[model samples]
Target: MRPALFASLLLILVSAPMTADCPCIPLTHVWVVKTCNDWNCASTELAVANGDPQVIAVPVGMNDSRWLVVRRFTAGAAVDVNDDSFQLKQFDGMDGAVKHYSGMTRDYHPMLMTAPDGQVLVLSTKQPEPRGRAVAH
Candidate 1:
């Protein structure tokens, strides 16, 4: 094949929007709380309605405990909230009458907690529609 043809094909492949093989349930909201001490605490919330990428900074301190609250979560979905160092555990609604790990089955809200670590928290999801794509001039 000619160089020009090969280059064109490569560009098309590179610029095309990538899609996931299986459908994913979108996350509506996420709340992160960090308790540094008895009185000092910090929290951040991310609303993922538009499927845009979100990020939050974890303050530097000896975090006594950390909690994460997520809404619109589904079982067996490709959802993840983690830093490079550690990943948060996933809980599916509830188990029987007893609530497990602060998870509520009524609204699909699950709470997750982890050890004190990580610098930044990043959240991203693949929306049903294709994201922005590049067009060659």
Candidate 2:
């Protein structure tokens, strides 16, 4: 190959984005579950721009991870929540766990609460399936 053409090809190869071995799941929003004391509770369909930072007690011996519910926008507008799906994600330091919905329903809602020690507890009407192998990029 010509020197100039070879250099150009090398540059292209070097700059090209590396793709994952497996298909990546796009993660856009994160929802931290919180407990409600009364009849009023914050709306669940909140966007990324609004994050609730109210500190709650974490459970005993739960010194590491934070529980989160994640959502991906597969349709509609950027902030719209129509026809979207929710997944469970847990983060403990550098490692994390995720649970995907094999079949999600609108009635299945989840809430998060923290123990006095800062350990998070995930509560939901419907139990999530086994931890998922799928990962978000």
Could you tell me every candidate's TM-score relative to the true structure? 0.19, 0.20
Candidate 2, 69-112: lDDT as tens digits: 33333333244332323333333322112222223332454434
Report lDDT (Cα) of residue 116, candidate 2. Answer: 32
Residue 45 CA displacement from its true place in model 1, Å = 3.3
RMSD of 1: 21.3
Which runs of model 2 end up more than 4 angstroms from their true locations? Answer: 18-137
Q: Where is model 1 more than 4 Å wrong at Cα?
A: 1-44, 47-65, 74-77, 81-95, 99-137
List the pairs of residues colliding in candidate 2: 33-112, 57-114, 57-115, 58-115, 58-117, 58-118, 58-119, 59-119
Scored by CA lDDT, what does every candidate get? 0.35, 0.37
Angstrom error of the Cα, residue 48, model 1: value is 4.6
